[model samples]
Target chain A: MKTRAVILYGLLFLSVFLVLPWIGPESIDPGKIIQFLSGNNTPDGSIFWLQRLPRVILGLLAGGALAVVGAAFQVLFRNPLVEPFTLGVSGGAALGAFIAISIPKLLLTWGPFSTLQVLAVLGASLSLTLIYRLAHRQGGVSIYTLLLAGVTISIMCGGGILLLTYLSSPNALVVFQRWMMGGIDVVGFHELSALFPILLPGIGILFLHANDLNHIALGEEMALGHGVDVKIVQRDVFIGGGLATAAVVSLVGPIGFVGLIVPHAVRRLSGYDQRLVLIGSFFLGGASLAVCDALARTVLAPTELPVGIITALIGGPLFIYLLISRIGK
Target chain B: MNKPIIELRDIYYCYPDSEWELSLSGLAIMPGEVVGIIGPNGSGKSTLLRIAAGVLSPIKGDVYLAGSDLKQMDRRTIARYMGYLPQELISVYDYTVEDIVRMGRYPYIKGFGAFKEPDQRAVIRSLERTDLTEFKHRRLSSLSGGEKKRVFLASVLAQEPDILLLDEPTSALDIHRQVYFFRLLRELASDGLGIGVVTHDLNMASLFSDRLILLLEGKCFRSGTPGEVLDSSVLKKVYGDGLLLNKHPESHRPAVLPRIGPEKSS
Candidate 1:
């Protein structure tokens, strides 16, 4: 089973990196792709390079980051259902997006992220910090406390989002609604470039804690007995998840289930060694989101559906299945 | 003079949610012996092991590991000298037997580290000791309750500590496995490792342990050789009535048998 998971996952992952970029709104000629690669510029090269390529890469990174972060949170909290979204990070990012849209667009870009993207990250970081504080003040952050605090913070942010949406004029409403229904529409390499620096380190830190995570998976008390610094690791991992999820949510608009579903699928497919699960979550998540985006782009042809909806449309059934199975069990 | 592997002095511990308080002036485990703790439920037997393992801190006490204070030493340092096995396993992810055992080497491993040759070798050694070398590749979920217990025991053995603290190590095992496990502990103890086991099986405790500490209401009610500690007078005080006693035919060690009748006790 472990061997099959690796092989099937590798094949699926490779298919996206090799094949999915070929299908988009405007189909690029394979001949043109070869010519562009060979340094002979084709007429469709800019459309392919500046638009399609960055978007695919962004989908890969965003999906992979969310899933890895999800796996980390699951292990840290000792609950399989925990994802960045459940922890109120997406709520924070959603609030940031709402705030960014409430005011007129600011002409600012940090590295590759827009001023709006930066605000979403800052908002996510702030929200997680608040959640962390609430959980930590009681001493040793138990899983129940974390989930409770997360839901409370998320509800609070939801209230804020409701107020912002209520005050919006019809003109702002459509744009706000579109942004809220996230899509991977990187206009150029700039946004992708900005995300790489933040995403890479965040991903690296989470992956590096696989052993500690393995101990933590048994239980927090067990982890401490195995010589883990539970308090420090918990704090650092929460920040790491916040940083990565914030970066992805800033640009991709809280693309749900990548974190929630991908890590889960990886663990079920492979065994529960964090060393395997984290890396598998990265590749599988990247490929899965890329496929979702591809379906979003080609399904409507000229009109595009938000990639987030496409993911939800597919992943929602998995969630219900999990619920039914849990109830049945 | 040979230093005791672990020593506790002037220890006071309390649970925040409960009214229980435990205060002990001193308890120590020397190298090369097995010490058994027998207590009623909530008598702080498990709590003592947790404090000694550095999983919990006493309100006021000094814990010495090889002459260094436990509070001053980091968790990794404490783990280096001592290994602890809890009463039961947590709800774990799908992990192979080998994967669970290898986690015992976490203290020796560094940041994002690969399992080195020594780590793998230690895992193999532990698997061999626990009679689980053949089952190393099996999934933990598929194992029976007792086999899973051995897998966790293997994980602790892989830690290769100077001392072992086990809570109820024989609860789920068959009689044969329980005897086997205790024999293994005796062998390990004779090899210069201090072992402290907290269990409710008075018969096995008397048979295997070099010394016994009987606890009640968070205090050590009796501490001596098993022969002295397992006396009928002490058993009656700790366990109340309906108690009968026998002896192991081969070892001639005391075996406790409890009789239950409707009118025996309230």
Candidate 2:
């Protein structure tokens, strides 16, 4: 089981991780690929650095962070269907992105970050803070109450986005619509630097709590007996998961299914140990999303389909298969 | 003699947003003793065990582990000395027995730490103690009701705690395993660990326990050797009328007889 798991994860990683950045719409020659990568003379130099590699890394970070947080959410809530968006962070970020694109007044850009991205993080933190305040009771955070609060906030955000979508001008509406469709399309090093600060540490915190997450899935009372500080774990994960989700969603509009499916896929491939599940989700989530994003670029060629579209297309069917196979077990 | 390993004093708990009031005035567990907590359903046996194990906080009163107040200590510190087994377990997850047993070592390992030799040895010893050494790699979903219980028991044992608080450890066990479980507790106690077992099986409690504490209506009704506590008249009050009890022929401990007819009305 040990070696088999490693090999399976390795194959998945290599197949997608190796082939994705190179096989875009403008295929870089192997000769040119080396020159551009090694910082030498190449006509396609800016294209490789500015477009392809950043997009690939964006997909990797976005997918890895979402799935990692999604895995953490599943363990924290003890529910299989709970995704990264279960806490309303995506809703908040989506509304922020929508407002930035649609509203004429608030559309401002900062160095290495846009007004939208900052607002998205702010919105996500706001929702998370609200959830934490509402869920805390009797010296404990009730997960059910947190979930209900998240759902309520998500519903409110959804309505707000719909209202803004209706009020925007036709031209701005089109841009907003495309942005809502979601893609891992980054143009330069600024977006990468912006994402790195938030996502890396958030994912690292989740990785540290991997074992504790396993204990939590047993039950809060049971986890406490196992020496987990249930309240602190709850708070840390909410903040960590919220920050990661916000960071990615603000950069590339919310990519669905990676967060929900990767954890289930990893669990099905491996076992229910969160230590393995967390690590596996990161690898498989990044790989799966990278592969899908690759298809989004190549399948449509010059048109450039959104990566989110491909993710749902591939992930929806894959999840169905996983669900059936899991049921069979 | 010396301070008990686990001591509960004046603990009061009423379920949050519920009317159920449960309390424990005082309880103690010393090393090298197996204390059985026996009572009818709804007598708060589970709650008492949870309070003592530091899983549930009491509104009023203090729980001191060894000599220190548990409130001041972190869960990790309390967990090093105490392990709690829940009454009902969900075994649908695809975790290996070894994976679960390995979790018992969590409190000892710092964050981002991997298992070392001592940790692995503790897991192996725990598996052996619960007689699940052969089932280490087996999935929990593949095990039987009784075998799954052993897997959980092995996990708690892997913690290597000085005190164990077990809620209904025997409820899901077969007769042989139930006897085996009691014997295991006896063996562990002899090695100088303390155990508190909550059980409905009066007869099994009588057979293995050094002493028995009978709980009724959220209070300690009686606490004494099995011969003193497991009497027919005492059980009649707790059970409310359907009581037929006698001494075991082999062990000479009290045994409850099956209700032969429609249970005597309360």
Global Cα RMSD, each model = 2.9, 2.3
Q: Write the per-residue lDDT of candidate 1 for residues A92-120, one digit (tens) a residue.
A: 88888778877676526566566788778
Residues B35-105 of candidate 2: C-alpha lDDT, one tens digit per residue: 99999888889989988887778999999997899999998888889888888776436788898888788
User: On residues B33-102, what C-alpha lDDT tens digit does candidate 1 reach at each position?
Assistant: 8999998887789988887777778999988998999988887887788888887677458788998888
Interface RMSD of 1: 1.6
User: Which candidate has the highest TM-score of all?
Assistant: 2
Window of ten residues with lowest summed lDDT in model 2 chain A: A1-10
Q: What fraction of correct interface contacts does each candidate retain?
A: 0.59, 0.59
Q: TM-score for all predictions?
A: 0.92, 0.94
lDDT of 1: 0.83
Q: After superposition, how far is residue A145 of candidate 1 from its true place, in Å?
A: 0.5
Global lDDT of model 2 = 0.83
